[model samples]
Target chain A: MRTIRFLLQKEFRQIFRNRAILLLIGVMPVMQLLILPLAANYEVKNINLSVVDHDRSAYAQKLITKVTASGYFKLRGYSASFKEELRKIESDESDLILEIPQGFERNLIREDQQQLFIAVNAINGVKANLGGAYLTSIIRNFNEEIRIELLPPGRFNPAPVIEITASNWYNPLMEYRFYMVPGILAILVTMIGGFLSALNIVKEKEFGTIEQINVTPIKKHHFILGKLIPFWVLGNVVFSLGLLVAWLIYGIIPVGSLLVLYCFLSVYLLAILGFGLLISTFCDTQQQAMFIMFFFMMVFILMGGLFTSIDSMPDWAKLVSRFNPVSYLIEVMRMVILKGSGWKEIWPQFGIIALFAVFLNTYAIINYKKTS
Target chain B: MENLYAIELRNITKTYGREKQVAVDAVSFHVNKGELFGLIGPDGAGKTSIFRILTTLLLAEQGEAWVEGLEVKKDYREIRKIVGYMPGKFSLYPDLTVAENLDFFATVFDTTVAENYELIKEIYVQIEPFKTRRAGKLSGGMKQKLALCCALIHKPRVLFLDEPTTGVDPVSRKEFWEMLKKLKMQGISIIVSTPYMDEASLCDRIALIQHGRILSVDTPENMTGNYPGQLYAVKADQMYLLLKSLRKYPEVLDCYAFGAHAHVSFKNAFEAAPLKAYLRGEGLSEIEMKPIPASIEDYFIKLLKT
Candidate 1:
């Protein structure tokens, strides 16, 4: 224990003394939390739409106004020629084109329906699909308005109409940042914990200081524990800072017990830091460790269900994400913060992370040899 | 049986790589209780390999080693407690202050600098002024001094220094030797390795090693005193031609440049008059030749040839 204390003291002293890394520790989480959530927004806006109105009627003009007023589309061009709008979609000036066929307000009243055409660019699939969906819904609302006006003034037209009501719970406004904050916070904490611990031992190896330590009476586990503790503390500090940023910048507060968040956080840090140590044991230099950590970090972040839902992934990918520690932490963060869940809700994830922590740390300890 | 030697290695062999290069092969040596022993060899003579095996940082494939009577393999935990090791490279944490590095190692051994200050004082006081400076900021000699101080902080029964003076300045090298001599007086058995042949004479005993083998192990004085051939230091204005002429002589067994003179060894005896007369016949003047004692380097050169 005394040896571990000294080791921690030395390790912490080194970590804080490096001004560049100190700057990194202070600024990286603040910058990532504040910047990434706003930039990684899932709700796509500013889609370009071109409208070609050939009808030149009162309702056709209203349809154009309704599409622009929905705020999902930007009316880049409004023209009476279909050739001009087709050129707009072809030149990538517009994501979609809504064309109303040549008719008076006559067709809907006389034949009960009229044909409208929506040609989407479909080059950028998400933006195109979302733009098409928004235009379709707005036209459906317009159709309802026309049908109501044409109805014979409470003459009891017998048509079965279903009225659907939707209310957004948890995030009533459905602010994208609120969903993103905790997930991004989980990732930022994961990066700091994983990279720092991975570099700790390998830096000693590069500097040839491990040879000096190997000859000492310090137990292998004591040395490993020393490495684990200082970085664990740093991970916690970054996590807390991220939380503060979340609450301050995005106005997000965890509705669940703070104890549950911290409990999972402490265990998550252990599992990720253990994984870093395991990599540290396998590498001989900081560069090797960094590359290995980067490769794993890439895999962890992509498959971690932050940007994409785990359930939406293919069967093989979902099976693979089951082993990613970051995914569980992200789930736990969302469950506890958004759902106001307590220990009862997060216990299963907690058990998996604790198991990961024990297995990785034990393997690293056994793999670390004082003698070759 | 009670172990008589402070350290021992018997028929130790270590091989590396897929091609299996032998680093230390069937090598055996010992050190006395308080003697300052030297492993005198050049850079790749397997000196560092031997230190690693005994320090429990590496394993020898074929044989056995014991430190303070404990097997290096079985009793490594106890052995680590009783030995201090300074590797060929400077291994202290560069970002940590000198004081921190020393204190860290001291704490690691479950001791304090004050407990072993006497063992390292002769070297420590010189570097104490810069204790707050990071170790990487120190000069080469100062870094070496700091490394030595850290290694000695635990007051081990035995200290292993592998080529401690390889890159140090000459004056600092002398001072380092002086420090080692003082530590010997404090009853700490020291086994230091060096490539400098001149430094070999300063140790109580040294094992001359080459190519993963020990050529000889004995007191420096006795090793030179038992010279088997007549050696001479020959000087000439045309030194290169003198070397060729000397090697051409059938009676000359060995001839090579050594400092300002060409050293030529003879099988049985050396007479300067015959060599001088021969040099004159070969159209050389101002030739000087005289019999001199062989040095550890000469002995090593002769061993390599045989």
Candidate 2:
């Protein structure tokens, strides 16, 4: 234990002595926390729509008014022809074009049906799909209203309809930032903890200091602990700073106990830092360690359900995410901060992370050979 | 009997890579307690490999070794506690200040600088004025002192310094040897390696090695004294030509250029007048020849030749 204390002292001194590293540790998370959430939003708004109404009937005008009033789109002005609308789309002025053919109202009354055409620009797929869906729903509602107006009150007709109402439980407004802040916080902490500790031992190897340390009587476990603790502490500091940034910028306060959040953070850091040390033990140079860490970080973050829901991923991806420690931490962060979850609710995630902490740290220590 | 020797190796052999390049061949030697031993050889002589194996930083493929009577492989943990190793490279933390590096090493051995101040005082005082300076910024000589200070902070029973003066200035190299002598006086066993043959004379005993093999092991005096034939320092006008002529001479056994003179040995003792006259007849002018005592370098070159 005394040996570990000295080692920790040395590690911390080296970390603080490097001015560039100090600035990076203090500033990187704050910038990422502030900027990444703003750009990560998936809500598609401000779609531009153009209409070509050849019928010039009341029905066509009403449809146009309704589409514009739904607030999902902005009218770019009526085009004279379908060719003109296509030109508008080609010029990047419109994302969708609705055309009401000639005699459309006459056909609806005489033949009891009419066809309308929609040309959607599929360039931005998400925006195009969501816009098309929103327009379909609005037109469906307009059709129901027209049917109600056309039927006489005395003529009785009965049709059953089912209404579904959705209420987002944790985030009532469905703000993406609320979900994103915690997830991003998880990634940031993992990065700081993982990369720093991964580089630590490799740096020693490059500098030839490992020879000096290996010759010492210090226990392997003691050396691993010394490496793990400093970075773990730094990871927590980054976590807290991210939380503060979340609270200050987005006004996101955890509904669950702060004690629970810190509890999970502490254990999560152990798992991540242990994994870092594991990489360090396997690599002989800082460059190799950095590349390996980068590869794993990309895999862990992209598949960790930070931006996309793990439930929606393919079977293999979801299975792989199950093995990612970052995924577990992201789940715990969302559950506790957004759902006000208690220990009983988060115990499984905590258990897995605790297991990772034990497994990875033990593996790292065992792999760190004193004699070679 | 166990405590009499500070280090012992028996037929230690180490090879590296798929081709099995032999780094340290079947070699063995021992250093007595409180003695200053040197492994004198040029680069790639496997000096660092031997030091690493003895310090428990490496494993010998085939050998049995002991430090202070404790088996190297089995008793590495206990050995680590009593052994201090300064590797061939300057391995201290570069960003860390000198004082911090010392404090860290001291604390790592479960001791404090204050507790073992006397052990490193002579070396530490030289760099103490720049205690706050980062180790990387220190001069090569200062860096050597700081490394030595860190190595001795624990007051180990045995200290292993591998090429500690390889790149250092001569003045600092002299000071480093003086410090080693002082450490030896306090009953610490010191084993230092160097490529500089002049440094060999400073050791109580040395093993001259080449190509991963031990050529000779003896006290410097005895090693030099064991030179078989009479030796001469011969200098003449056009020294390069004189060296070639001496090698072709019938009586000449060995001829090597040793800084401004050709160190020549003869197969049999002969009068200087004949050699001097013979060199002049070979179209050499201002020929001078004198019998001189063989130095460690002379003995080393002789051993390497055989």
TM-score of chain B of each: 0.97, 0.98
Chain A TM-score relative to the true structure, per candidate:
0.95, 0.92
Global CA lDDT of candidate 2, please? Answer: 0.91
Q: Which ten residues in a row have the lowest lDDT in candidate 2 chain A?
A: A153-162
Q: Against the true structure, candidate 1 has what lDDT?
A: 0.91
Top DockQ model: 1
Question: Candidate 2's error at A14, in angstroms?
Answer: 2.8
DockQ of 1: 0.86
Off by over 4 Å in 1: A52-60, A78-92, A99-112, A150-157, B236-246, B267-287
Taking all chains together, each candidate's TM-score versus the true structure is 0.94, 0.91
Q: Model 2, range A1-372, lDDT digits (tens) per residue?
A: 678767888888888878888877899999999999998988777889999999999888989999999888899969559998899999999999988899988887778678888889999988899988888888889877877777777653576567899999999999999999999999999998999999999999999988888988788888888888888888888888888999999999999998999999899899999999999999999999999999999999999999778999999999999999999999999999999998999999999999999999999999999888
True contacts kept of 1: 1.00
Model 2 — TM-score against the truth? 0.91
At residue A197, candidate 2 shows an lDDT of 92
Q: Write the per-residue lDDT of candidate 2 for residues B84-174, one digit (tens) a residue.
A: 8998899998888999899988888888999999888878888999999999999999998999999999999999999999898889889
Which stretch of 10 consecutive residues in model 2 chain B shows the poorest summed lDDT? B269-278
